[model samples]
Target chain A: MSTVSHNEITVTGLSIGYRHKKKEVVIASDLDFKVLKGQLTAIVGRNGIGKSTLLRTLARIQPALSGIIQIKGTPLTAYRNLAWAKITSLVLTEPIASKNLTVFELIALGRQPYTNWIGTLTASDTHKINEVIDRLTLNTIAHRKCFELSDGQLQRVLIARALAQDTQIILLDEPTSHLDLHHKVSILKLLKKIAQETQKTILFTSHEIELAIQLCDKMLLMGSDGFPFGTPRHLTDTGAFDKLFPHESVTFNSETQTFQVRD
Target chain B: MNEKKSYRLPFFLLTLVLVVGFLVNISWGSIHIPFEETLNALLGRPTETDSWQYIIWNYRIPKGLTAILVGAGLALSGLLMQTLFRNPLAGPFVLGISSGASLGTALLIMGASFFSGVLTQGLIGDISITVAASIGSFLVLFVVMTMASKVRDTMALLIIGLMFGSISAAIVSVLSYFSSAERLQRFVFWSFGSVGDLSWPQLTLLLTMILLGSILSILSIKVLNTLLLGEQYAQSMGIDMKKSRFILIVATGLLAGSITAFAGPIAFVGLAVPHLTRQLFNTSDHRILVPAVLLCGAILMLFCDLLAQLPGSAKVLPINAVTSLFGAPVVIWLLVRKQKMVF
Candidate 1:
C-alpha cells in the first residue's frame, strides 16, 4: 500500500484557484494526495467543483495557489518547462485550431519537447508515433485531417498524442465529455490498459462517476466540503461517495455502488 | 504521406505562372519594348537602343523586383497574423501598422509644410517621409508590444490594434482637412499605393527588411504549428507563449511596416494570398504554406501590377484599386465555392 517511491505525483497541503487583481478566489484548498505509477485515476465531481483547476495546477499550466506539488520527489516548480514537458503531458477539452494536419502529424507533434528546433521527426520519433497509431487502431485514419475525425476517433488520437509524448504522467480534462456511453467506457478502458501496459500514471477528470468507480484504480472525489483521494472501493467503504451529491436529490447505493434517485 | 504529392502539381503550375508573370511584367510597360529586347536587357546584353536598357535597368527590373519582395513580405506577414490570431480574417494590416505609417506620412507632408523649407528638399524629403513612416509604425509597434505582454486574449489584442488604427486614422483625417490642396494631393497619391516608384536603394532596404522578417518567421515555424492546437496545448508542448507571440508580432510588424513604407500599403496581397495558398495547397502546415504563400503572393502582385499599368495605355491605375478589384473576387470565389472552411 505504501508506494511512495512509485508515486508519479504527490501534493502536500495544496491550494489551487485563481488570483485576479490582488483578490484571491480559492476553489479548493488544503489538498493532499499521491498518484501512483501504472494506475488509472479519475477526479470526479459535480458542476463547478474545480476539477479543471486541479488538473491545470498539477500540469503546471497554472500556478498553484499555495503548497507543495512534487513530481518524482522534485518540486513541481523546480523542473524547467522543457524538462517538465518530457515528464508530463496534457490533453485538454478545448477544440484544437487544427489546420491541415493529418492524424499522424498531429500525434507526431507530441514529440515537440524532444524534436529538433524545426520539429522534424527522427527515426525513433516516427517509430514511436507509428507504434501509438497502431496501438490505437488509427492506421486507417492516420492520414486523415484531425478536423475530419469523429469524436471517438479524435479522443483516441488525443490520447495517442499523449502517449507519443513519452511522458511518465498524463493529465486530461474531460477527455470523454462529448462522447457517447459506449465511447466513454471504451476510452476509459483504453486509458486503464495504457496505464497498465506503459506503467505510466494517467489521471483524467470526468462526470461519469459510475464508470470511473468501475474502471479506475484510484479516484479523487472533490466535494464542496472536502477532497478525498483513495482507491474506488476504499472511498466507497469510507462513505466518501455518499456525500458527493446533495442528499435530497440522489443517494449512493453502497450495494450497487451506483447513484440512485431518492423517489 | 501522400498528401504532399497533391500539392506538387499546383506548386509546379504556380512556379510556371510566376516565371511568366515576371517576364510579362518586365516586357509589358509604357513605350513597349520587344520581348526579345526585354529578355536581352534582363540578361545584361546591351540592346540596340539606350532607352531600352535605361528603362529595363532603372525602371522595369526594380519595379518587378519590388512587386516580388513586397508581395512575399506582405503574404508572409498576413500568414503570421492569421496564425497568431487564429482568425481567418486576420491580416498584416489588422494591427493598424499601415495606418500608423499613413499618419507619419501625413504629418511629414502636411505638418512639414508649416515649416516651409525643412522637409521640401528632394532627397531630404524622401528620407524624412521614410523616417517619419517608420517612426509612426514603430510607435504603434511599441504600444502593441506593451499591450501584448498584458493581454493574453488574441481578440483583445486585435481590438486594441483596431483602436490604434482608428486613432491614427482620425489624426490623419484632421491633418488632411487642415492641409493645403497640393500637400493633400501628395498624401492622397501616396495612399494610392505604388510599386513603380521605389528607387534602387529603397528597394534594397525593402528587400533586406523583408528578408529579416521572413527569417524570423521561418525560425518560428515549429511554434506556429503548435499554436494551431490552441494556447494551453501549445504551452503543454513546451512552447513559451510569450516568446512565441512576441516573435510573431515583431516579425509581422517589420514585414508590414517596411512594405507599407515603401509600397504605400499594397492591399489584398497579404490578406488574400494566405487564404488562397491554404485552399490551393490544402494543408495548414506552415512549412508548406510559408513558401507557397510567398510564391502566390508574388505572382498575384505581378499580375496586379501588370493590370495597373493598363498594358496598352499610358495611364496607370492605382495599385490599391487593382488589388481590391482583382484580389477581392478571388477570395469571394474561394469562399463561395467551398462549403466549409478548413481552419
Candidate 2:
C-alpha cells in the first residue's frame, strides 16, 4: 500500500494502560496502527476495554506505557504543550460546569491557543468563530446561554469549538453518546463532512458501532487480542468485526454492518 | 453588542451606591460629622472644627477605607475560590484562613496568659492582636497551598480545607476553655470582626495586599474564565492547571489572610458578592465579573458598615453580625428564586 503523507498518526510497539502506584497494568500492548488524516475514525469496543485509555494516551493527556507514536512525521512527544494544543484538540466526556457563558463565548474559548493574554478575540479570531458558527448552523442561538441549549445544539457547539481551535486533528470521546438516533446520525455526518471539507483527521470513541460503520471512513476496533485498524468495509470483509465480541448471544452481521442478538 | 451595552447601567448604579455608601459611613460614626463637613474633610479642606477634621482624617477615613478594602478583597478571593472549586458555596474562608486567624487570636488572648510572665518579660511586648491573627491565617494558608499543589480533585481541596477548619476550631475551643473571662471576652470581641479600629499604617498594608491580590486575579482572568468550564476542559485547552491553580490559591490566600488579619474574619462578603454580581450581570465572563464583583463588594461592605453604625446612634453592631444578617437572607432568596443553581 502506498503511504500517504496525510493522516499519518503512526503507533509502533505501543503499550497503554493504567499506571497504579509503581506498576503499569497493561490494557493493550504491541499495538501498531496509523490514523489517516482527512478521515473520520471511530474507536469501538466493549466497556472497560481501554478505549478511553487509548484516546487519552493518543491525545497526550496521559503517557503511553512504552513505544513510539508519531503525529505527521514527527514524534508526538516532540511537540510542546502549546504547540500540541494548536495541532490537536480533544473533547472529553466531562460536562462544562458553568452555564452563564453564551454559545458565542464558549465557542470563542476555542481560540485560547491563539488569543492574547486576557483571551480577548481579535478580528481574525472573531471571523473564524463566526465562520465555524455559520458552518455549524449555530448563528440562530449563538447569543443564547449554554444552559438554554439542547444537548444536540450543545454538542454541535462543542464541535464548532474544536473547529474554531483550528487544529489539524480533533479527538472526541463519545460525542454522540447522549443523543437520539437522529442526532447521532447527524453528528457523525457532520464530523464526516468536517473531515472532508477541512482535510483534518476526526476520531472519536463510541458504542454506536452500527452508526459508526455507516458513516466512519475508518474504524479502530480495540479488542482483547489486538487492535484492527482499517475501513469499515475492509474490516468487515476480513471478518474482523465478527471476531470483535467472541460471543454467541450477540452476532455481527457483515451484510448489514450491525450487531444483532441471536434468536 | 447590545447585551454588552446593558452591563453599563448596573455598573453605573453600583458606582453610585459605592459613592453614597462611602459618604454615609464617613458622615455618621458615633460622633456624627455633617455630610458637608465629611465631604470637606475628604477633600482635605479645613472643617468647621479641628476635631471634626481629626475625627474624619484619623478615624473615619481609615475605617471606611478599611471597609472597602476588606469587602473587595474578601469578595474577590471568594470569587476565585468558587471558580476554582466549581462549588457555589466555596468562599474565602473555605480554605480555613479565617479559622486559622481565629486560632491565632485565641492562642494569644487565651494562651498568652499561661506564658505571660516569660513572653512579656522578653520578646512579646505590645503584640497587637491583629498581628497575631495574621500570623495564624498565614500559617494555615501556607499549609493549604502546600496541599493544593498535591491534589488534583478540587473536592479533595475543599475537604482538606474543611479538615483544617475543624482542627483549628478544636484548638480554639480548647484554648477558650482554659482562658480567664477577660481574655475570653477579648478573643470573642476579636472574633466578632472589626473594620473600624485599624490605624492608617495597618490600613495601608491591607490596601497594598488587596491591590496586589486583585492585580494577580486580573492577570488570571483567562484562567479564571476557562476554569468555569471545569478542569479537564481547561487542561485540554492548554491551561497549565497546576501552575494556574497554585497562582489562584496564592492570590486567594493573600487576600483572605490579609483581610482576616485586619477585619477579624469578616464573613459572607466573600461568599455573597460574587453571586450578586452574577445575578446582576447575568454573565460569567471573568473580565466583567471580576471588576463588577469587586465594585459591588465595595458598595455592599460600605453599606453594611454604615448600617452597623446604626444611623444617628452611638451604638455599633459587630461587623460580622451585620454581614451575616444581611447577606444570608439575600443568598437564601437567590437560591430559592433561581432554583437552578449554576455554581
Highest lDDT against the true fold, candidate: 1
Q: In model 2, what is the error at residue B29, expressed in angstroms?
A: 1.1
Q: Which stretches of candidate 2 lie over 4 Å from their true place?
A: A2-4, A246-248, B1-6, B113-116, B120-127, B335-343
lDDT per residue (tens digit) for residues A1-263 in model 2: 64758645888999998788799899988888888879899999889898898899988878899999999989988988788889888787779888778899888888888987899788899999999999999989999989989999999998998899999999999999889999999999999999999999988999999889889998999877778999999999998888788677688988888888976
Interface root mean square deviation per prediction:
2.0, 2.3
Task: Estimate candidate 1's alpha-carbon lDDT, on a 0 to 1 scale.
Answer: 0.89
**Weakest 10 consecutive residues, lDDT, candidate 1 chain A?**
A95-104
Q: Where does model 1 exceed 4 Å of error? A: B1-9, B112-124
lDDT of 1 by residue, B1-343 (tens): 2243566777899999999999999999978899999999989898989999999999999999999988889999999999888888889988889988998889888877667776663533666777888888888888999999998787799999999999999988888888899889888888889888679999899999999999999999999888888888888988989999999999998899998888887777888899888887778888788889889999989999999998778999999899889998988898789855766
On the 0 to 100 scale, the lDDT of residue B204 in model 1 is 91
Interface DockQ of each model: 0.60, 0.57
User: Interface RMSD computed for candidate 2 is what?
Assistant: 2.3
lDDT of 2 at B257: 93
